[model samples]
Target: MINGPNFVKGFRVTKVKEFSLTKPKPRTIPVPQKIPTQKPHQPVPESTYRSPKEQEVLQGKKLTNRQKAEELLIEANMEQFKCANPEKSEKTKRVLSEIMREEDNKMAFNKVKVQHAPMKVDNVPVRLNAAAILRERALYQRQVEEELSRIEKLVDGARDPSEFLEWQRQMHARDLEKQLADIECRRLEGKLSREEALLARQNLIQENKKKALIKKEETEKLMRVYAEKRLQEEKEMRDLVEQVSEGHKNTKQARMKLQKYKQQIVQEVAEESRELLRQALEEAQEELRKKFELIREIRAMESVPFIRQTLVDLTQTAGHGLNCEMSIVELRERLALLKEAERKAEEEKRDQILEEKQLKQQHLLDTLEQISLHRAAQAKAAVLRLEEKKSKSQLGKAAIANNDRVTELQRKLEEKMTERKRQAEALKLNAQRSTSKSCKNSYEEKHWKELEESRERQAQLLQYGVVSGETANRMAAYQAARNGTSQAYVMPS
Candidate 1:
């Protein structure tokens, strides 16, 4: 019993409360109400009528420390030890220590305590024994159930095992037929030639044959596996039945009867399955025949001229020799020979036509060459005549409109040369005067201003003395030749 710090205070210490069991008071009974007459009786839900204690638990009210201790004590007593003092017994002490350790672990490690109501026995489902039920059932009902179970097992995960394979085969066949039809359509549309169409058909037939063989093998393997599993299951069933029969040693007649009924059922199912397989095969064959007939009609209606001609030749050449007595291989070989001969003949004819076309083309090319030469000669003569007339006209115009500006040009050149000479003399006098009067500060702004002013005056005089356009152009060309730069030609306005 540990004392808290409050016990040392001057004020009266709060006494530790001791745990005590209190007697419960009698609960008051409620008065019953009379039933209603007109309205329909609605049943109240069980949850609404739950006891207060159950309601408190459902509301997630946690137990206090004393209450938890009381629960532990009660659980300890419920172990039912034979010792006079259960609290002092070794097993009791061990159980209490284990419970304390678990509680301590829960408190120390488990942060979350999920509060939930215990599941009731009424909520648990009752397990049934299938064998017991089967044993109790009548023979006729049992047989029916067995047959149904066997049928369900045969179906497994498919719609019906008997029909699934047939359906898959039919679907595969339809897909193949559709692909063949598309190929034929492409051939008719000229997307594929006759040889390509034939090759595609042959490859498709080979693929179909291979797929059929694989499917047959797969089906055979599946049947073998199924038979093996069935045998194993039957053996297991027989062993189980023998074991059960040995326990009773009196149901031999019933067992024999059941076995005979099962055999009959199996034989009947097998016959029905075979009949269904035969019917599906016949239906599929019939459908294929109808589809082939339709295909033949469409092909005949849409046959190309070349194909029709080839067929006609084949019929005319080999029709008499072909008989029902001939084997397919012999017939095929004969047709192949006829086709080969026809191909050779067609090739020769094509070659002859190509030779004739070459001859005609050569003749036309020679004729065109001669005509082009004659036209070219006439064009050359006409061009020469036109050129002579143009030269003559150009000479007459030059003589009529000749303007002799050489004298005027010479006069302008002399004036420009005199003006340039005066400017040169003035620049020379300025340079000599600047040199004579040059001080240490001669490169200063004042001296620069004077030099710039003289240059501006010289430029003004040169602009005023400008010559005619022809003379200016000639002077610019001459200056550019002398200066080795075109910059002199780009003169200021």
Candidate 2:
């Protein structure tokens, strides 16, 4: 790089060279001035008395600057004039000089004045001046004069002025006389004031007192009539009460009689029901017994050889002849007979079985006795042999034979004992079986009897219209008596 002093020296010299100026030569020439040309004026058309349409356009049209300035000056002048005298802006005074000039405008303005004159004057001050007062007073004087003249004419019957003038003087005197009469009447009225008012008040008070007396008399008469009417009503009420009490007593007695009749009817109904129930129960029992007898008869006939056909032929022949209205007691007796027959039949069967068993037992006993006797004989034989053996001890062969025979006899006795034990066991078993069967039969019979009693009682209760509880209790008692059993009874609450 160059030294700082040298760099500065070169930069300064170049600056002066770049900015160096040369001397100038002068030459003279005049500068021209430009003047703006003014636009030519176009005159506005003169304002003519236009129709309403033309006038509206002229009034609403925009104005040139000059016309605007002129209008502003005119408005300023008018405003200054209004400020100088505010009263002048009020109802404009009529100027005779202006009216006399401009004939058409004056005539138009007068016509407007004639139209608005009353309204304008109405707004003016109404000062009561001498002229107005005089005019009013003159009008009053004229009206009075006309009245006076008419009155004179009427008094005189005048059709002419001469007669009227003569009547005018006379009427003046008559008016004076009338005025004096009115004054006299007013004086008389003033003098009578207190006496007249007192008389009027007395009349009014008398009329009021008479009205009050009449009203009181009428009220007292009405009260007397009302009291008499009330007394009559009380007498009627007392008579009615006595009649009602007598009727009530009769009704009460009748009701009691009716209640007694109802009780009698109820008792009759209960008795009838009980009779009907007994009859129905009897009838049902008879029917059941008859049916059972018929069944037994059929069974018995069937059991007999060829007897069913015989019975059928007999029934066909006798059915129409038989009595249908058999009583329950008769049927029950018949059923009992049948039951006895059946029991006899069962007893006969039992007896037959017992006879058979006894015969068998007797036969077995005979056999056992024979066997015991045989065993005894064998023992006797053995005993005899022993005796013989003892007696003949030297005969040895015979003694040995007797000993063997005693052993054989002992075996035969043991076999017979076993046979007797077996027979006893068989008899015991047969007896036990017979006893159990008899017990079962007895229990079934008892149960059937209880059921039959219950059914009979139910029928009785149904016919009587009594409750089942009472019927059931009676049935239980009846069953207990019949079956030789005890019964518990429960009462209803």
Best by lDDT: 2
lDDT of 1 by residue, 1-493 (tens): 4665555547786899866657576798988999867988789988777776875764443344446668879997785442122237577889999999999887986577777654333245534344433333344355568879978877786355568887986676556555544443343333223334434555576588679989999999999999999999999999999898788877778899999999999999999999999999999999999999999999998775553343333323444564555555677898999999999999999999999989966765555555456557669999998997687556544543342343343344456446545655665686677677765366465645654464455455557875554555555566546545452333344
Work out the TM-score per prediction. Answer: 0.17, 0.16
- Model 2 Cα lDDT, one tens digit per residue, 188-299: 3433443344345655765886899899999999999999999999999999999998888668778999999999999999999999999999999999999999999989
- What's model 2's overall lDDT? 0.64
